[model samples]
Target chain A: MTIHHQSATQLTRIICAGDISAYEVTTASLEQIQAENPNLNAAITICAEKAQAAAKRLDESIGRGEIPGPLAGVPIVVKDNLCTEGVETTAGSHILRGHIPPFTATAVARLVNAGAIIVAKSNLDEFAMGSSTEHSAFGATKNPWDHTRVPGGSSGGSAAAVAAGWAPISLGSDTGGSIRQPASLCGVYGLKPTWGRVSRFGLIAFASSLDQVGPFARTAQDLAAALQVMAGHDPHDATSTAYATDALNTALEKDIRGQRIGICPEWMSGNGLSTGVADTVSHAIEVFEKMGAKIVEVTLPKTQEALAAYYVLAPAEASSNLARFDGVRFGVRNEANTLPEMYKSTRGTQFGDEVIRRILLGTFVLSDGYREAYYRQAQRVRGQITHEFESAFADCDLIASPTSPVIAPLIGAQTDPLAMYRMDEFTIGANLAGLPALSIPCGYSDSMPVGLQLIAPKFREERLLSIAAAYERHAGQPGVAS
Target chain B: MPDITSDDVHRLAELARLTVDSARVETLAAELSDITEYVQVLRSVTCTVTPSPHAMSSVRKDEVNPSLDREELLNAAPHSDADGFIVPRVVG
Candidate 1:
């Protein structure tokens, strides 16, 4: 049967039943990546040889009577920001054009150990900086549904790759809607776990407090399966804590008959929601009501500050984390007569205009004179936003909103850069508060997908998944492009 | 707003330890001022003190862990030699 782009859960069932060998699956995935990627530019790097080798290894294990691990033989792509051994890990930046990670990221290792094959490294905005994948120095990853439009980013390529059948499942990092926004813009399922739930040891940091590794898949079940493997603690990542991921797995069995889904009023009042975006979300709220979910209209008053605080806080932390890329150590470095000159020249020359703008802005915000005025102020407001979410959750089980203000924008549509940043309006608040959030395809407009976002309190991913699964099961399931 | 002057932009650039393209500095200066003005909206909110937002409070127990080897760390470098990544001269 045509299992191309089917959920990994669905595909694995077939593999277990012996309908297709892992080799067949892997080769199909490779061919899909090759055929589809050129039109979309979703892949920044492909590993055809290694993928074949990995598929062969899986096939031998199955022959030897070894139990195919969970998600056995499913192919997945990863955002380039995650470190993977033997593959170049440039986060769509000229600075790290050909840099490789000698040791694999824990998330990658977990997926590999679970018998999943790596397909390719997907494109992204430089250093995970922009809402559109357009900022990539390598090249923009276009939305699969409409090539003229941007694939929402910095995980746009990850989301778009899954939507386009290049990979059934993929990994994306969400510092501030880096996963969900793209997953929304491209019709797919993306989940950002509560902070510290997933190990971040090898995720190249965009912002320390906000960065989270999440799974993007064609279906919620597939997302849950991927997260079950990738979530948990690594002593290597001090911020990541240990957890029994069975909570997420068990969520599928949780009854969502009487759950209270929060209809956040802040979403309705927001300025940028397109007619398409609002209609899709309104339809979702109606579905929740019909499924016996008590819908409560909730007010998160401080949410107005979410956008401003995210920009300030994410950039402030990014300025520090990205300092390692100077010519003194790794990645691209232009030689100069002096060491100081080399550091300046390398970054100034290699980094893109958007990345440079961020560095300068971050440098200024965190500067000695401006620290109290900008950085400290942002921290205080971040606290307020967090408190606002906590208070809102006191009356609701899952907070719901539109993942993006609109479907993917046309590539380079806005002349002003700050106007482009405004597209992240709906999803950034969850990141600021360190909450678990998911984006599931709800409806379509102009043949592009819109996502209905469900957020839960810290580490409450299982319940969030339960709500999403119930919705997906009834609403024709997520991942089908309209 | 600070009504930031050209000298202020030059000084901030110096403190940031990079040279700003002089041509772009004026436009950037205006944008920064607007952003800084916009961010002033936060000053009105009073927050009850919380030490830090981190959920895990106690220090993580120090323990032995397997780290990426020297070769692994050096693999990310753009310019490396037998000893390690080569640089122009830190001790100028």
Candidate 2:
């Protein structure tokens, strides 16, 4: 197989064994990125020189018989929201167009420390506010399956890059389906680890509580391998968990027989769920049953209300988290006479429309008169949703549903703001409840891939991976879209 | 649900410190109203449980570590000097 076709696990083994040099793999990845990025626009920044230098160093270390890290010599892509020291991290917003962070995000630093070379920074929706990647300041990423359609967002570029064979693994942050929905549209695997599974030290914050950094890969094992390196505690981030991540790689190889897979009928036949996606996910359940896995019908009545709650809670947090971007500090500055004028002009002009809309909505929700009615009420609902998921997990090991309600829509197709928010109907519950969730390609609909979402209780990423790996063994890896 | 009027949008823009163009205010008002109406579903559901923030079980000792280079951080600012970041005249 060509270097681009090999998974990260395969590439590492070949490089370690001295059969193929890391330089060869890195060059092939860079070449593919250069040739295909123009048509797809999946990557915003390409680090050819730095990637080549890093790959050459790995080859030298291997030549000397020294062991590099577990992910030695694998080329990876990171979503632009995660900071890479001295590299321009824009978070897909013009406000940070030329801002180079002074420090690296803990998750990205961990991957790099493990010998993974970053080939590029993928695109995302501005501040991860929108479900469709069309909200990005640097143009929309076209779906690899069909260019006319979007690849999903705000992590659309990361998902598209993996789907288009630019990289085997990429990192993306999920606020509300930013990772999983795009993974579904692009026909790849994407996971949003439990809220504190990965550190958020240097990730440009959209919603502090809802955002979790995870990986996108073409193979389930690649997802596990990437997570094994990225997960764990970071002292810099207080919210990072001290839980053990050593079992992730081993868990994927275990048998999934007799595992209880929960199916929620309300979500399965929920409003606006496309018939194509519904049928594909239902078939996935049958396949699990055929493989000796028990399928249980579970009820999560409050989950349908999660979408409304998330919209309120996320935007409310965004207003506060994003308040740091005044004209005086880092990022773009608009010259003005007064300091207050500078803050107003800089934010008003630099932030995109969606960002402004979100900030306004956030401000309104948290406003004095409406706080009890909207913001506090949303928090109460968020608590209830978490309780609902906890109760449902007692009957099942994992919950299964459609990752996205529909396939990738045409660019500019979902201009209505409310319509765009509904794209995350099935996926927001996981984020609200702070659970580990993943999307794996189950089948194709309308010649495009559909994702089967598996959500597990907090800190249970291993179980999700084990079942995903088993399903991949049966369903086969999705064909690369070129 | 009460309709989001132009005055409401103006007030929100003022509070958020964002300048909205005259051309866009009407559209913003309509969109915000529609979203507000949609989210009114939350009122139908009762949630009496008190929301507890996620537990932070791994907070480290409060010790000062080496910070980033002062020059490097100052250099990223739009206006900075040997002393600190410079902003528009506020006290004058």
Using DockQ, give the best candidate's number.
Answer: 2
**Deviating ranges (above 4 Å) for candidate 2:** none
Q: In TM-score terms, which candidate is top?
A: 2
On the 0 to 100 scale, the lDDT of residue A186 in model 1 is: 91
TM-scores for candidates 1 onward, in order: 0.96, 0.99
**A331-444: candidate 2 lDDT, tens digit per residue:** 899999998899999999999999999999999899988898889888988888888888899999999999999988989899899899998988899998899999998888
Model 1 clash pairs are none
Q: What would the per-residue lDDT of candidate 2 be over residues B3-67, giving only the tens digit for each residue?
A: 88999999999999989988999999999888888888888888766778998957788899998
Clashing pairs in 2: none
Regions of candidate 1 where Cα sits further than 4 Å from its true position: A479-482, B3-9, B49-51, B57-66, B90-92
- What TM-score does candidate 1 reach? 0.96
Put down candidate 1 lDDT per residue, A320-434, tens digits, no spaces.
7877888666677788877777777777778777776777677778877778877888888888778878888999888888888888999878656667777777788888889
Task: Tell me how each candidate scores on DockQ against the true complex.
Answer: 0.50, 0.79
* DockQ score for model 2: 0.79
